[model samples]
Each structure stands twice: as structure tokens, then as C-alpha cells.
Target: MTSESQTAGTRVLHLSSAQLARVSRALDGDEAAAAEFDSALSSDPVRLLVEVLSTKSVPAGSGVSYGHTFVTQHPTVLARVAIGYGHGLPRKAGNRAWVTWSAAGGPAVRLPIVGRVAMDEFVVDVGRTPVEPGQLMCVFGDSDEGEVPLGDWAAAIGESPVSVIACLDRRVTRSVVE
Candidate 1:
């Protein structure tokens, strides 16, 4: 009843192997248990939604964002998206990371984050695709839908998968969709 030795699931990090085994046993179940567990952890529900501010056309040689770290190789559309380092987005991801956006009634497309990330915003090269202001841009979410996976976001910041999910600041609005 008191002391017993057991092994735990490898996914749990805080517990010793024996203690983990005990927890694993307690949480373990049969067919129904497996189904429940799979359903619970199958996908991440959180998505960082950055509102699109504006869009414009820049010449092929135009410098993008701050410092001209990225220059458009061709005339393209640049979109400024709200939410940046101040909102828990990693500034290091600037000019390195990318996001997913779809023009009105258009297919989802991957857009590169260009130039330096500012305290309040970042830029994306959307290429001739027309985008409107106030449209929401997905910074990280379901990859099946062409959005950037959480792993990629974590990788951009030199961190693990869980760290990116934990980086959301209070500035990000949360709404329950039922």
C-alpha cells in the first residue's frame, strides 16, 4: 500500500522512472482509455491570431521592413501583421521564420517573414496575392491546413515544442469557440 516500484511513460519529464511508471499505470487504460487519451492530446487547440494591418506593393529592389535585411527579389506584396516581440513573439524569428495566410477565397499560402521583427509588428512577403486589412494571420497552428506547425515556431526560437505554446502573452486575446 505504501511503497512500490514502477516505470513511467517516457513523455513525462519531471518524474523519476519508477514514479513515472506508477503514474503511467494509474493513467493507463484499455481500449476506451487509449481512445480518450488520443482524443485529448491529438491536436493543439491554441492558435496565435495576428490581425493584418495593411498591404502594399514594393518594387523588386525595394528594401523590406527595418534595416533592409530583406530586399524583395521581385515586385511583391508586403503585409504588416500585428503582434510582435512585445506580444511574446520571438524577435529572433524575424527574417527567418514564416507564417501562413490566404487571400480572400484563395488557397492558404506560406509567407516568409522579412526583415527585422519590430516590437509591435512584422512583415510578410505575400507576392502578388491580394490581402485585405483586418484579416487574421495565423502565426502558428495546424499544419494540415497549411499553417505553420508549433514545432517550426519553436525551432525558430531555438526552443522546444512546449516552450512556444507557453510563450503566449496576455496581450493575445482568447475566446472560447465552444
Candidate 2:
């Protein structure tokens, strides 16, 4: 069995048939499951990019998004993302998920979702970053650029990647990348 840890809390467990069964029992009490693993925690080909529709400044104690699930800690700028649970993103991601925003010609900055994820949109606290509309956000992309991983996204929202992908209906446009 092999496993590799990736950035953004992605871990892939590679196990053969026997090893896999052993792992299952090990989860019960077998200490033999402790071993280095070589798994598929590598960068994935699929990435989800969402656009920034708008941004706004809020004072401290400000409640963000629907239900006020999260409140502003201080004066910060919140940027709205263009996709949400209705678009296949997990609704549970509200205040639990993160996205990567790359400044124009700069490195990617990881931002947290500040409020409840809506039907077609979400919010990110872009603190201190002069973000603007039309900016592309890497909701889950390659780790090389500090983007979130699909696995991490699933874990954050308590779902599997398969389920997440299946939730992406025709309403969400699909683009092929080489």
C-alpha cells in the first residue's frame, strides 16, 4: 500500500487487493496499516475556475451572505464568486471552503468563503488584496499555483469528488482543456 500527501489536504491511498482488505480490517484495530503509501495525490487535470462578479467593503461585525453564517472579523473586502452549489459546488462549502485568487501577474492567494454559499454564487474574503470584477478564481486547481484541490474541496464540503462532478449539470458549462 502506498499513499502520498498533497497540498491542500489531498491524500491518495494506493493499495492492492490484499492490502486493501487489510487496510479495512486495520481500520478496526490492526496496526499493520501503518506504512508509507504511494497514491494519486498528484496534480489533477481537472480544475474549476469561477469568475469574480463583484466586490464590496464591509465594516467589522458585518454579517456576510445569506443566513449570516459568518461575520466579518474586521474591515475587509469581500469578493463574490460566480458559481455555487446550484452549479455543482457543495452547498456545505459556505464558510468552510476556500478558493485561490491570483493577483494580476502575481502569485495565487488562498481566500476563504466568508458566508453561506448561495444557489449560483458565493463570497470570498479577499482581505488586503485589491481584487476587481472579472478576475478569475481557481476554486480547485493545480497545487503548483497554490490552488485548492478537488479532493480538499470534497473533504471541506463532506462529499466525494464523484458526487461533486455528478452534481455539475448542463446548467454549468463544461470546457475541455488540453
Each model's number of backbone clashes? 3, 4
- lDDT score of residue 97 within candidate 1: 84
Superposed Cα deviation of residue 26, candidate 1 (Å): 22
Task: Kindly report which residue stretches of model 1 are placed more than 4 angstroms away from their true locations once superposed.
Answer: 1-42, 103-106, 176-178
> In model 2, which regions exceed 4 Å deviation?
1-43
What are the per-residue Cα lDDT tens digits for candidate 1 across 2-67?
Answer: 211111101101212332233244345344433332233225333466777788988889987678
Q: What do the candidate models score in CA lDDT, each in turn?
A: 0.63, 0.67
Residues 20-133, candidate 2: write the lDDT tens digits: 343345445544442211123243334677678788999999998888989998999998877766666778888888888887678888899878887778899999987888
Instruction: Kindly give the stretch of ten consecutive residues in candidate 1 with the minimal lDDT sum.
Output: 3-12
Candidate 2 residue pairs that clash: 2-37, 2-38, 3-37, 3-38
lDDT of 2 at 77: 94
| Number of the top-ranking candidate, with TM-score as the measure | 2
